[model samples]
Target: MTDTEIRAGIAEVARAHLGYEGELLDDTSLVEALRLDSVRLLTLVAELENHFRVVLEDGDEAGIEHVADLVAVLRRRIG
Candidate 1:
């Protein structure tokens, strides 16, 4: 899938699962913007994996500080 599609899926998942209704820009901070705690982050990751049908390895989320980071990770996994 393209980056835009991944991003849209992310937005949809965030809205549907996390109750986040704000804009999700590439530079949007995961911590500051989404306020993702460990559990919430994990939930998002799991949902993303399910949505994209990819298994994200342990520690794959290590340096994901922004939306772009997550998108990049998903793009790599999906590719």
Candidate 2:
């Protein structure tokens, strides 16, 4: 999938899991902006992995501090 599609998927997951309706900026912190706890974040990860058919490493998310960071990880995996 393309970056746009990956981002859209993330946004869709955020909408479904976090009740987020606004645009997700690059700088949007997943914890702060989306209010995602560990469980919700894992749920999002699972959904992304299933949709993209990629096995996301635990380390892949270590440095993911923002929505853009998450998109970058997905981009690498999907590409």
Candidate 3:
């Protein structure tokens, strides 16, 4: 899938899982905007991994700070 498609999927997951209704702009910070706590953030990561069929390394988790970061990770995994 393309980056746009991956981003949209991630946004949908965020909306469903985090109750975020605002526009999911590329630069939107998930941590700041969605106010995701540790549990919710881990859930999001697990959901993304399941959806993309890729396992994210534990070290890479630190780099994910926002929807854009998630999208970038998904893009790399999907590709």
TM-score of each: 0.93, 0.84, 0.84
Q: Tell me how candidate 3 scores on lDDT.
A: 0.79
> Which rank order by lDDT, best down to worst?
1, 2, 3
Using alpha carbons, what is the TM-score of model 3? Answer: 0.84
CA RMSD, predictions in order: 0.9, 1.5, 1.4
Per-residue alpha-carbon lDDT of model 1 for 1-79, expressed as tens digits? 8999999999999998899999999999988876788899889988998899999998888898899999999999998
The runs of at least 3 residues in candidate 1 whose Cα sits more than 4 Å from the true structure, single-residue gaps closed, are none
lDDT for residue 63 in candidate 1, whole number 0-100: 92
The reply for model 3, stretches above 4 Å from the true place, is none
**Candidate whose lDDT is highest:** 1
lDDT (CA) per prediction: 0.90, 0.83, 0.79
Q: What's model 2's overall lDDT?
A: 0.83
Residue 71 in candidate 1 has what lDDT? 96
| Candidate 1: residue pairs that collide | none
Checking candidate 3 for backbone clashes, the offending pairs are none
For every model shown, the clashing-pair count is 0, 0, 0
What is the C-alpha lDDT profile of model 2 across 1-79, one tens digit per residue?
7777888988887787668898887888888877778787778788778777899986898889988899999999887
Candidate 3 residue-pair clash tally:
0
